[model samples]
Target: MGERIKLPNDPHSPEFWVAVRQAQGIVGPVATDTISALIDAYEAAWPGLPRKLADSTKEKYRQSLRVVREAWGNLQAESLRPSHVQALIETLGATKPGTANNVLDALRAMCRWACGPREFLSRDPTQGVTHFEQGEGHKPWTPEQLAFASDNLTGMLRRAYVLGRYTGQRISDLVRLGWTDIDDGGFNLRQKKTGARPWCPIFSELEVEMSTWEKRPGPFLLQETGKPFTTNGLWKKLDKVREDHPQLAGAVWHGLRANAVIRLRQDGYTSMQISDAVGMSIPMVERYSRYADRKAGGQAILLSMKERKQDKTVKR
Candidate 1:
């Protein structure tokens, strides 16, 4: 054996013993809590008590987290590698590319937070993994589709669709609204994902439509008895509507909110104006206004063509 090298510290001290043990690589395993365990706790603590997230956004992340937890919950944080994450993307992406990308984003975000100051993770396992390519976000409801729902749907469905189209609020929040939620001025409510309280102004047209339903019993528009509609309940109603009308294919509730943004874009509203009207972040408003931006680009091209033709005629 080589000569003893520990001459600096007191051999009898616990500190010295810890150092000696560490020197021999005899440290215990990193925190034994599994990824699943951490995820379980995270879900429980979600939306932050005081800070709060919008209910719909919570559901979206909840679904993604549930999927990731099902796949990697038992695996140790350090055990997860880029290849493992890639495999998850491939497996999940087969059925729904968009949802697979959502899951990937959720995992990456959660793992990044875990590795932050919390030290729940030694490092982010999702490193170097790219999210699956996704198509453009939710398809906005057309004005014609809105008109159809307004005309066709008799009781609750008609109200839900029209309100969604005009207010541009999330279904989760919108369905819970009652007479008290709206007054002569406008509709007022807190966002489900973000906790911001947005007061959407009610136009005369929207007001006229809402007046027809305000006399009903509960504050909730789409209700069973007197209670607000659950997220799934609202979806089922929309699904039934789709079954009846095929023209409404591929449209979802979130898209209903986008309809207002799209309309604002067509009216040539800036990103800031749309954000103000829709109670969304400026960035989100910009994203929703992409179609409007595209239209504006075309208009610019037309203007340039006209200017060139006019210049040529004047020179001649």
Candidate 2:
């Protein structure tokens, strides 16, 4: 019965109920068109909209949609209003702003699809809902913190840190990075979030670290079991180590991406150069490297005058 229905086999889901009814050869209305039913239909609509989205994105949507279904599963899909969506967002946004935004995004996607060719709903309920304002995002690891982790973190955990620092790739792309992706130049990446293919050159520091490590058969980074880690698995493993060490409390994996930008900028790499190397947009590269750029500008201003140079020369 589970095999017949392509959706998850959870008996609590409306899809499961509908599947059960059909399997039992029962007559009458199988199920009403509710939010849960809409979700089931959307997910099952293969060669359809969900197929166009990345697996990670679809998973996120499923998570958010599950929350929506639980809240309003019994309500008719067409009857849903923007006010209801706004209230839900406000309720969740009160505590988990990020999660509330994710729910809003998921509903917007579903509602757009529903209004389009799918026609699941006549109107979009999440039409006017606004996303919650988020903070500046992940904090970059300082050079001192990076050095501490380098000296202390052991095995694959250390390798994960180094890999993130050098590659500036997302955890999703990092996990998928294999030994086969390496070449004479550097690492080859087909980013999961964006389809952009970026080439990461091997920095001297990264090469020195890589030389000390064993050449694994699969991914350059691996679990203790010698298997490639899932994105969340790697995060949890690294985060546990971060929590144990007080210096690394502020360091997150994604922050390494910003650290990479800062490092590049400090080394005289242009924003365009960093963007191309890291698979980030120029605007994002500029955003991440702003401090480095400002520092460079300040130094240039201080050194631009002959008097400052003469004073340094006199002191020397």
Candidate 3:
């Protein structure tokens, strides 16, 4: 019989491995593969996101995922059920419905990814959760508020405020506006969300404002550094104005778009015309024009129906 191979003093020592290498090869122990946590789903999902999401969208998704982890750290993905998700959204809805809906939407996307080729989880808990009403967070800015901004805002912010109020375009779209976008026709917008080419009339108001400023080399909305601002950067810039003028509370940059639609409606424009001008769907135009409709109808009623002594003129 062949002699047994010589062995090291300590069987588990590095010398033992060395000896094994001299004779028969031995593979080292492998670290165990990690089990995925709730957060892992997000990490995995991001890479596989089919469309290239905007930075704002990516941040929002990351934020929502962080929220889930904070609420339920290392929670088994499969343990999340429809009832659990619904209760979570209900709690968030009490404070910020828009935010709650955003979180829910992000989670739903995660769930779909999990159910897809990746299979991070078995089912989506968010499916049955009813979303809170959006648009309740803020309303259109009033004329007084616009006047306040005009008086208070200075430099780039003043121009930004004017563009938002008049163009009916999102800050994302407006900040990217350049000399190239301007034509003899008007302010041409390739909307970010809809990808629709919309034209805003060169109102005498915006025209006068633009005439005062020298055009920068690139985007019209240039910062002190001669660089175009990201949407968030523009938002932060405008938000600073709020610190000085509290009257602008609830009258954020986005609300300016709504205000434009509302003002157009108030000027006796039909919903269809408003829709065409603003590049909005018919449904959206109707929704925005409701106040205008009621206001006009009430005034018409006052002329026809005699004002009863009991009735005071209803303010719209």
The pairs that clash in candidate 1 are: 54-192, 54-193, 55-192, 177-219, 178-219
Candidate 1 lDDT over 89-179, as tens digits, reads 9887898888888888778767876776667778888888886765667878776877776678777777777778878888767766777
**Model 2 residue 68 CA deviation in Å:** 1.8
Question: What's the distance in Å from true for residue 127, model 3?
Answer: 2.2
Strongest candidate by lDDT: 2
lDDT tens digits by residue: candidate 3, 1-316 = 5557886664323355455445554456411111124344355445546654565677887787777767765466677788878888889899988879888887887677667665556666778787787563336788789788888788888878888888778888888877677868577777776566777776788888888978656777877887788888888887777776788876777788788888888887887777767777777767766666788899988866666533555532
- Output the better candidate (2/3) by TM-score: 2
Q: In candidate 2, residue 255 scores what lDDT? A: 96
Query: For this target, which candidate reaches the highest TM-score against the unseen true structure?
Result: 2
Predictions: Cα RMSD each: 10.7, 5.5, 11.5
Off by over 4 Å in 2: 1-32, 46-55, 193-196, 214-216, 223-225, 229-240, 265-275, 280-316
As a whole number from 0 to 100, the lDDT of residue 186 in candidate 2 is 87
What is the number of residue pairs that collide in model 3? 0
For residues 149-210, could you state the per-residue lDDT of candidate 2 as single tens digits?
A: 88998887777888899989998888887668887768877788766778888898888888
Which 10 consecutive residues of model 3 have the lowest summed lDDT?
Answer: 29-38
TM-score for each predicted model, relative to the true structure? 0.72, 0.74, 0.66
- Model 3 earns a TM-score of 0.66
